[model samples]
Target chain A: MEKKRNMQSKELICTACPIGCRLTVFQDEKSENWFRVEGNSCKRGINYAIAEMTDPRRILTSTVKVTNSHYKRLPVRTREAIPKHLIFSCMNEINRIEVITPVRMGDILIDNIASSGIPLIASRNLE
Target chain B: MLNYELVVIGGGPAGLAAAIEARKNGVQNILVLERDLELGGILQQCIHNGFGLHIFKEELTGPEYAQRFINELLEMDIEYKTDTMVLDISEIKTITAVNKQDGLIQISANAIILAMGCRERTRGAIRIPGTRPAGVFTAGTAQRFINIEGYMVGRRIVILGSGDIGLIMARRLTLEGAKVLAVAELMPYSSGLTRNIVQCLHDYDIPLLLSHTVTDIRGKDRVTGVTISKVDQNLKPIPGSEKEYQCDTLLLSVGLIPENELSLQANIKLDPRTGGPIVNESMETSVEGIFACGNVVHVHDLVDYVTEEAQKAGAGAADYIFEEITEKIPAVPIVPQEGVNYIIPQNIRIDNLNGFLDLMLRVTSVYRNAKICVRADEKTIKEVKRPHLSPGEMERVRLNSNIMKTIRPKTISLYIDGEKTQYAI
Candidate 1:
């Protein structure tokens, strides 16, 4: 059996302001994942390529139950980054978790959900 | 100083719309001062298609849409000054401007408008530690050079910020024979529209780097390379992952800041988030007789939205001629609640209610299959279901004024409801 050396990966673009860099990642066949990145022109591209290849993380967007506020529950995101492969898994755990307020911005509703360092938190304060 | 009924600064979409509306309302004396050699504002440089979808029902280029308003202004025979730069505006509606041949001239009006639009956030604002090179330019500036001036920015290019302009420029440069290295973004998602992602980056096989930020720039007189690093939750650069890309040109499309120097000088209160004046329902600012619209209020992703907002502002200025629409203290102030980033129209006026109230907002992150719930004082006022939601695109939620008038909350809050972020509304 032959061992694969170099691996290829695709990237998703999200500058949020307009410079969309959809980068393509290629990992070297040798050890250390001695990676060589192509496409991006800035330091941002280099970093994104490396992370996408190594530990891909994402911010989970969901909602928590907030009582005693203007209305009902409010939308929120995890303050911490979820592992690249565990995004959907953490989202599942987040879906199951809900909190009641008075919740403030950056309030942690759930800590280390599913053993991932990601914390389901409030993006805005709810009184 | 010459006195007039209204003086519109900048001959962009907002200014032209305001001028025409003022004239329609029977404001006899009107003056539109333009800083450029011609009347058209930034629209002249944006030659790409995707404009006038809402207004004309067809995708026209930026210039054509601007020309429509320009032609209408000419038809009305409104008094306008081209190559005129309005330097200052005092509290008394006095304007001072200068031109190469015209020298200095001062004019006064019963009402004045600031429609100066916005400027692109550059490398300095982002503080991308790098050598001061000549090759670096903003995405818009690069577009102007390549599209209108017919100058290739670089043989090899790297763009920062996955903005609409940056993405479009990537494709544009590819067509013109420039090798776009990649488009880098600090966030994990693309900020631009999904359509642009497919057409601009995907189609060209151009890579979009997400959750990444440029940490350093390399080169002396001109750009040679840059050191980039991965960002954590706080967007701080990660250590031991520094990598470099060799390129001649670096374009920054990081963001846009509303051109509000004059607004600030005029003492108009500004929203720190949008970088535009804190405007109410009528597009009237804190300062009396001073109004604003278009990109001068906030960076708009779509030009049609600018027209829609500007038209209202223009009409509002005209209405001021016949009626004194004094703003009453807003009963409810719209603020971000949860998972929400920010909302526009910082203040909401209920008196003399308009047909509908539109609230412009952006999310802090990405989500799918969600319902946006707008609340007033702990009671659900409005909720709308959406299939896909992302922070890249700005969301406009139009509330029924009649319905809004009935339910007034001291603080209007917005949140998401669905399987992931389900909440009781």
Candidate 2:
């Protein structure tokens, strides 16, 4: 006895780890995106698919500005994720942008960065 | 030609312990070589606490935990060489080294142990297609900046991978007045420890985005922003649900790979599953007189385990030198069963096996509840029920040598029940 395929399909291999997930990607027309997915055991696998197929992004780790603080620079993270293609632009803006003193962790360092609507704040606070 | 009775590669927790144990076991001539100027490996910069609790019975910062061993080895009159990089090690028990002061030196050893730790998987390793920006950093590197260098890396930061390091860094950045925004993890469940999630993210009100990841890194001279989205099970990006975060810095805490170049050059048999040397119950490698432990053997969450393994390597080396390993080596093959990823100590021959034989493992998937069993030739040798199991968390089980001897079967299988998957029958 053989189990028939649910509407013939192809397997999309994911490189989440060495354990590549042979996933079955089926388009669900409701959302109009790569709709239904299976064969991925981890959440990262599915997210890896959507990002790879359409657009991708990364969580940026860098510095922020401080206002007259003892420490000139402070570590920071973005309030939201940036566009996959615009990662360099965001970093370039950060490199050029410097603030003066009084920055704390979670403080808004840059608001509406490149109009992407993601805020960059200090990942760590400085005196 | 430099020579010694025992030559330990790496000065980390594992290497140091092996050196000390070897000395204690009457190995007079011993030497340790470290690539970094500092003897401690990743521990020196890990400033975060919660280390050494298992080994020392009290919580200590990574540096402090390393200090205890560093100070002990220092007092033991052990010989150590820092800033010495081992280029290669020969199967005949010879090691080549180059230092800033000493150009090249070949050292022969009676016994050698590979204790080199692991390295973090970088963005390049993950192959995130895009422009190479200035603001990208591994989470550990970023940690060194805020804690040691005392410099700001970026104003806006987006963390990829909700591992313990990333989660802790998210909270650290948030505390330092930076906007963490959220932690995006591709996996539905966080790969970090439960405590880290609760303390670092949940307590700080930082959101943990499960089933999400950063699809791209934007910016040229630096980072400008990034695009992220939820993924389907097939792990393909979905359109229309895409969202963007305008941030400068991208931090990756993807994963760690065991550093094992010396082992490879030594022609040591490597466990592909662990990317480390495969050792027997005595922690001896394929090479008669060589041994390996710690992250070099297999990455461990607790330093206590590293010390424990180092002691085994040390003791095994001592036994080999004293010609005590004489009994018939009851070899057992480790078979990774359903829903199980890999198991350390691929083989075991427990003659003087004492206490509990701790076997480290990784699960294939997330299981709400599972029971781990060690089966040998249709006989259950050991079993331990776990409340929950995830691939992110490494599992350790204990079995007495006395019990292991009962199933003198050649092959031993570790499998999980109660969680059904395609991989699991």
Candidate 3:
């Protein structure tokens, strides 16, 4: 029997901007880092396709408990995109932490969240 | 009555940007009135990212995007009042508003910018046949509950409509540990951006049922399930195609309507197609010195476009206040021809033409390999070829002022030369 070649293609819609370019990414299993991207109008789509195929990540945005503010929750997001698989774990960790009021935008609510080296920062000011 | 050079209603992104731009252009004594308790408006509840990519050159969450403008307005010392609702507006640029701090105050302004934004279409608007249930909520209301009030609307959800808000809520509820059974869109193609469909549904494995709609709702006190049915070409629910999904909540994101009560009160002429005020190139409404932008003019897909249009209204208001705009030529009416839904700035003043005119429009349906052509009477002055066009995404075309001046036709019209088909299912 002959050995089979491990080659795959995946289609993705770029969410970087509203243009939503359709990207077709071809992956050669022989070389993990090599990816050929097609159907994108801009250069950003190439990077997006490659990043999406390998180590998929997403910016997690959710609300955190707050004290002394009229709002019960203050919105926060990971300073950078974290591993996609860890979103629920990160949310679980985020749910356990609460901050006092007078929080400013860009304030770090959690440094190195979920051991991902991504800080969770406030998205807006809470008074 | 209190007096100001410019008065902007609704302290959302549109009103904030308009007031700030007017101040920057030498307009003094500007006031922004917002009905919400906070200045951020609906953006405060929108915690998701993918905003401000065009204006800020970086992706920011909704609140972050609104906060930037709020900070700028605060830094510029522009006057604004939250929790204030404008009751009426007169044709002469007078505003009647009320708030807890200042009850029933009237203000006169040289220029007024209408930026009340838009409101979601509820279940009542769509008339989904079902029992009145407590679990039914608009997608925006659910967003406010989850992101703002820290409350989970329901454990199981069924979203009715594939608009951006519905798609976003699908992911939001799923991330919050709620099972979003599926999103049903009446149309064959989703009326939301393609990216939203992929990120919000595809990534999370949430099924999107196109050409389907909620025909009935079950449960007396709260929604226990919803009957989804396939619709035919005429958008009528087809018989014997009903499927039931057990869910506790039903979220409707059917469409948005521009809030134009004040516009009507001011005697501003409205375009029936857009359900917004008719204006010229300057963003000035039918009533002189009264401008409208953002969602009040029409529903916008992006906040960046809203900011750009609001800036035009702001600068136009400032120019009117300064008496700098002089009528050089009569305004030319812009007519939407075949394959086009409607065009903003229903008319254009030749003198008001800066360097170029940006015409924003949406096609009636999906088209491929289409040529959007702008004509001046019998001559085609501008044309651009697009590989793909959909009603979900808005399109913009820029016409040079030099070419516009040369033709100076009595009427300007826009039409698309292509075949319209349901190609986006």
Candidate 4:
């Protein structure tokens, strides 16, 4: 068996707290999981690193055009974090839609947007 | 004239929290007057997350955190007025307000809580020398355009002053496909939180130039570019270090000043440092029965702390409404000596002794391996070690009623101990 010559390592800053410890995640050649994290002050950093390496997510916030309301636009957000890859596409879909008046806070604008199983909910009331 | 037990001016997060607490504390007839179309104030435009960490123990977006309080306030059947603007507030607890439906309404309230939040300082306040340009917007104005109005302010941006709003906007404008050239801060260290510096700037490869100032702005109609230069120790521009960046928009996040014109009209003594009404341990200003809290008291780093402070003000207002003149408790003034910037509740009232009171303060500068020393009448009452302290973060110290009882009505000072003065060369 030939030995592996290179292992990839990535550096990230943990956004868990104000300390913002610089975290480094490296691919372990011998381990099956292929990832080991270091330089984190707490367990949250390790979890954040592993998730970042495997799959990343972000809470999307944007505005939707509204008609028949005092305000011209309505603020909306993903009820839960969605996959990072779908952010722009989700924004595109959200940009294409226009909501009517009498919207309440927490009203779902789109169900399972971008097939992410997260609904885009209204962030404020526009009556 | 309409009479109520309490009238809260401004229905932002602070006003909502204060009204809810006051209603819960037996002030049945309470009204919250909000000038906006809805209850939530600036939180509506702040679409990003990282709020409500301390109060809810979970990361929430601005609107979500605000809705939690709004739901609670509504569920309790508390009265509130949206789209109402308070014109004048008299020292005798009289409030005059106006709206479309309730035109020129007057109310004689037993107590009043001023929860009017802060406003962002504009370019005119800082006097950034430039031609009248359309692309120059405050960071919050840009945020409102992109986050709430669904309109992009510009394609290219340069943010001045690395406050939390500026840092967040750097990431927000980037996510919206705008090119952010750099963020210039006048101070040697950023006033924004450290986590924001990492996620907002470093993660996005945006440069944060500390000890930098925007010397001149270039543009006639829309912003064409800006000239930024390094500042000397005295914060004056260093001529040789000037550099230019081509950008369409220039965003200013210089500072926030408490909206206190109504407070001044009420003749409430203002704190020169905080730009807010000065209050004692009860959150009551020099004017009796009138309480103040939230950003109107002083700019806060977190909204949760605003809610907490509002609750204290709410409770204090309710106590004044319910209790009679049984006794007068002598209070002592809290003097900020070395390292302490300013302390809220400028005086510690010793009467109606609560179990504990929290003293909120901010340091003048950054320090390492330091302990905060609290003294009363020239005697050390308490000492607490803080591993790291910065001007950007607020420091809170809890004073037990027992410890406060031991001290007499004299001078109380808070200073830093064991502060490292110099770095090894």
Compare the candidates by lDDT and give the number of the best one.
3
| DockQ scores of the candidates | 0.01, 0.02, 0.44, 0.32
Candidate 2, residues B199-222, lDDT tens digits: the string is 466545677788788888888889
Residue-level lDDT of model 4, residues A1-127, one tens digit each, is 0112345888777766655566778888676567887888888998887887788888887778988876777878898889877887898888888999898888999998999999999887678
Off by over 4 Å in 1: A1-127, B327-332, B408-411, B418-425
* Model 3 residue B134 CA deviation in Å: 0.4
lDDT, candidate 1, B1-425, per-residue tens = 78888898889888888888778777778899998767768776665556787789875556667778887898999999888988888877788889887799989887887889999988879988868878989999987676445467897888889888888888767755679988988877667776577656765678888877888887889899877688887999999878789999988888888998888888999988788998877788888788899899988888888877877777777777567575546535777877777777777777745898888888766666778899887887788886556676778888888887776557788887754432110
Docking class of 4: acceptable
For model 4, residues B1-425, the per-residue Cα lDDT tens digits are: 99999999988899999999998888999999999889988888887888999999987788888888898999989999999999999999899999999799999999999999999999999998878778999999888888766689998899999999999999888877899999999988888987688767875789989899998899888889999999998999998999999999999999999999999989999999899999888788888889999999999999999999999999888988997322256668888889999999888677655888888898898777789989987888889998667878898988887767766548788998866533210
Q: What is the DockQ of candidate 3?
A: 0.44
For candidate 3, the per-residue lDDT at B67 reads 97
State TM-scores per candidate: 0.74, 0.75, 0.95, 0.92
User: Considering only N, C-alpha and C atoms within 3 Å, which residue pairs clash in candidate 4?
Assistant: none
DockQ of 1: 0.01
lDDT of candidates 1 onward, in order: 0.74, 0.76, 0.90, 0.86
B242-265, model 3: which lDDT tens digit per residue?
A: 999999999999999999999999
